[model samples]
Target: VEPYAALVLGPALLLALLGPRWWDRLLARRGKEHWDSYEALAADYLEALQGMPTLRATGAVGRVRERLERRSAALHRTTVAKLRVSLVDTGLTDLAVQGGTAAAVLVACSSAATGRTAATGTYLLLLLASECFRPVRDLSREWHAGYLGVSAADGITGLRTAEAAVPDRGTVAADWASAPEIRFEDVRFTHPGSGRPALDGVSFTAAAGRTTAVVGPSGAGKSTLLSLLLRQRDPDRGSLTVAGTATAAYTLASLRRGIAVVSQDTYLFHATIAENLRIARPAATDEQLRAAARTAGIDQEIARLPDGYATLVGERGATLSGGQRQRLALARALLADAPVLILDEATSAVDERGQARIVRELAAAGRGRTCVVVAHRLDAVRHADHIVVLDAGRVAATGDHTTLLAGGGVYASLVAAGRTAQEERAA
Candidate 1:
């Protein structure tokens, strides 16, 4: 009915048709760059900060700083590009709205000049034209302001829809009456994109209330085997059982609650010594902390610190020696007082004398509990009640120190190599 109003509607309809497509393509394209660069920068920052001590010790801070600078530059470039796209799209949207308004005025002016409409009607048409453009203009401004929300929506949706790789299915937690035995039956796992399986049909039993030590060559999947037991990744082929119950049947929280792990690279955040120890057993008494630390053979060293138990160990315990850090981790695990404890080269950095003492301590402290240990240093495993020797992701030998030493197989060779290395270091 109002033909002149159609003039104001044309550019808006055209913008409505084309603007969204442009934003989707240009905004998303630049947004992805922003995301990628941000991820890269975050990874670089984490690596640099965590390895800061090593970089400084090796005099490679400048090298790491250069890499960080490059990552930052890439992120900056992505940010500037994204800003430019937003600005251009916003300017184009404003131009379309203005163009539609100007067209409406021109059409109304023609109607009045040709003596087809009164001044009052022409004024009314112009006012309606501006009002019509108001909604479209407000939409453009809001789009520019809220584009971040649109860009982040995909990431949010993906997280909400994501499925766990290994679903947690149990409603009831596994209840063990005693220190549970750990058993892996025909277990196998291949890391994604790797043809070689990390663990192949690996089977072993960490008997209840006994120490079971896993020893292996460098690439024998010792760590991979431990990862499976911790449920860091579940087996692709077989079952892991605790106390004769399949791990898959137990709630992850319950299963993990029953086991404690201390690895060579055990982490300790920047916190007080007692604070770190308390992480394992928050309700642990001070005496309990001291007893555990003493059993780990680190109590003397800790006592010597200026602040004693209140001392703040720097990032990853950088303030302490490697052996001290390992001992501290051992104390934390002991504090957890779980049914099972794992030491994956946990005491490798300690002096052999201290290692021997800690081993004996674990043997004593482990009296009603089970301990699983993985150590390249045979001293830590030599006295273990049961030892599983791994080679190429399979058990090559299984026995105690005497039987395995008598076998004169891979286990024997490892012992010989270790003795030679010790001799070399001594000489």
Candidate 2:
């Protein structure tokens, strides 16, 4: 009877040992295919949705819709493939369990009929055979259930480890009280995953307590230089010094504390205007907030709002006009009172009238700090104490606005192009 029981359990044991491996392989392949297909479909769907306004304007909505449908069909096919694999796995599992049980019962009954075993022994043999396959079934079921979660966990772990590797060395203080000058000597920087250098051997000086304007064509690396100054990135081969010390000597916190920046893409929290301003100077008084707003040329606009300074700024300040958002960003920066002020195309979004007012306020408020202005509009920087023109990642010329115009070089060409565009817009 025991030998008959062993014969019944032998094949079941073999199936249990190998079934999980086969099942997991099928599940893993299907899961990966489904994940990839779903991700592609989702990305395509989001892009189509975001471009719907333009598609409608151009009468291409049908074309976009067709593209989306194709993506959806592909995703559906992958999902169906996954379901088929699961069904096949389930069928295999049932076959192995039922076949092993019937074979065991047949062998045991034959042994009992020949007087080799009694009915009690036959029942015990059947129970033992079932128990042998139980663990294998549980393992196969659990593996399928957790495979997707395992894949997701691996991705998250890699991301966290990569982010943790960037060093944070902001333990030393940077000199900001004296309004130190910034000097870049032969600075070069290449962005990650890019073939070309963003800034190549760029050398210039931003004098202390005076406004310096940087002008260039679209890819002349004006923004790259500002990023280096803020220590957002380190140069590849050259040195960036604040005052007389290398920027690396200062902690990131101390370095950023000395600089205030307002750029074209302004970000505002979903809070009251006063709350946004207080982010720059957390303990500022109401009078201080109003004063900063006045300096930024937005005080009157804020005062006119129904809630005044207490009005909520919708997500990313979307509720406000472009000019108002720009002014609010400036007011927040002003409240910081950093020794270095950076205005990177700060008025690029405002109308001519608002641009003029903001430029005037910028010039007035930048009296004592080291100001760096990167602008395409020549008029905004005409009165700068110094202007540096960059061409193809190198400093092409450096002088006051008038001096560069008189030189008849890259700066002159840029000024001419700017004037032509302005005239065209006016006409």
Candidate 3:
């Protein structure tokens, strides 16, 4: 008993001191994954906030709020449940160790009274027994922390499951010649959660070296057509071909490599201007970066910055104006140098002067590439060699701008609406 006391007391004290650290480490490791998941959710919410104006205008703010609330509640509930489990495990472990130590002391005292051991021996026995259980107590405490970590891991696993369900076409291919030509063969599409189709048997040949402009009203499926071309979503029925090959035959990577897109809602990483441009062409030289910026009419703004192209654009290019971001996106697409280009309302957010410059640049850029422009502005599509008008997800008309306007159908109405909207805004 005396010898045991000497062995147990020293090690027990040491373990008691070190035990909490192990627990803390386990908790930290487990919590890290959950923290990351929460961060991703935060980013999604932030992006939603950035589009608040649009959501409000479209009357989707309520739906957005509801979704946010639900997610937040779920996260909160998960955290609380994990905390409760950890607390219970830790509490039980502490109680068991303390209770066992108390009982051991009583037994040692009884042994000494009955002459089974001396008083000193009994005291030593009690101390030794308490010390022996110290490591077990430490282990119990660690288990609590481990459970906490496990809970965090569980949260992360759930988040990953959700992310997996989202459709993500992998990285685009880098080769150009191997790219496929895009074809819409009687393609029909209905948006997710929408009652009607956005495209109805839309057939078109968007071969290389020609520009095709889709002109239409607010909900005319112009954007949907471009989305299909980009392979963001597949058609509900009929096949889409690329370069004489079916889209389904090629990997998403190979299909997307054949095209580049610039939309009105341009997204920019929180990086330097040069870095942003380099995303389209990672190996591009500084000279090439400057050249692309100049072509996009954003060189002047970049020059004004203290770091020039190296200046950070902040989140989503919030530091820059809408026109600047649009131009930056244009520069990115140009630097990509894909065989096919898609400009979906690319100039909608730009001012009149910026729009004119983009139009001119696009015309020049469209000379030898297959360009598909979805424009709400009449002036943008007026010069297109071929114009396609869509109404209620169907091809309502197809011709040159002048011819379509003369036809005095849906196209004419859209043109009239544009003029009216412009005039009203001006007034």
CA lDDT, every model vs. true structure: 0.86, 0.85, 0.75
Candidate 3 TM-score to native? 0.77
Q: List clash counts for every candidate, in order.
A: 0, 1, 2
TM-scores, one per candidate: 0.83, 0.81, 0.77
Q: Hey, what RMSD does candidate 2 come out at?
A: 4.0
> Tens digit of lDDT per residue, candidate 2, span 112-213?
888788889888887877777788778768866776676466567778777532246656687567678999999999989989999999988999999999
Q: What is the total number of backbone clashes in candidate 1?
A: 0
Candidate 2 error regions (>4 Å):
1-18, 94-142, 163-171, 191-196, 270-272
Candidate 3 lDDT tens digits, 34-67: 5555666697699798899999899998888888
| Ten-residue region with minimum lDDT total, candidate 1 | 16-25
Model 3 spans with C-alpha error above 4 angstroms: 1-89, 115-124, 146-155, 159-174, 178-180, 424-427
In model 2, the Cα lDDT at residue 361 comes to 85
Sort order, TM-score high to low: 1, 2, 3
Best by lDDT: 1
Task: Look at candidate 2 and give me any clashing residue pairs.
Answer: 170-251
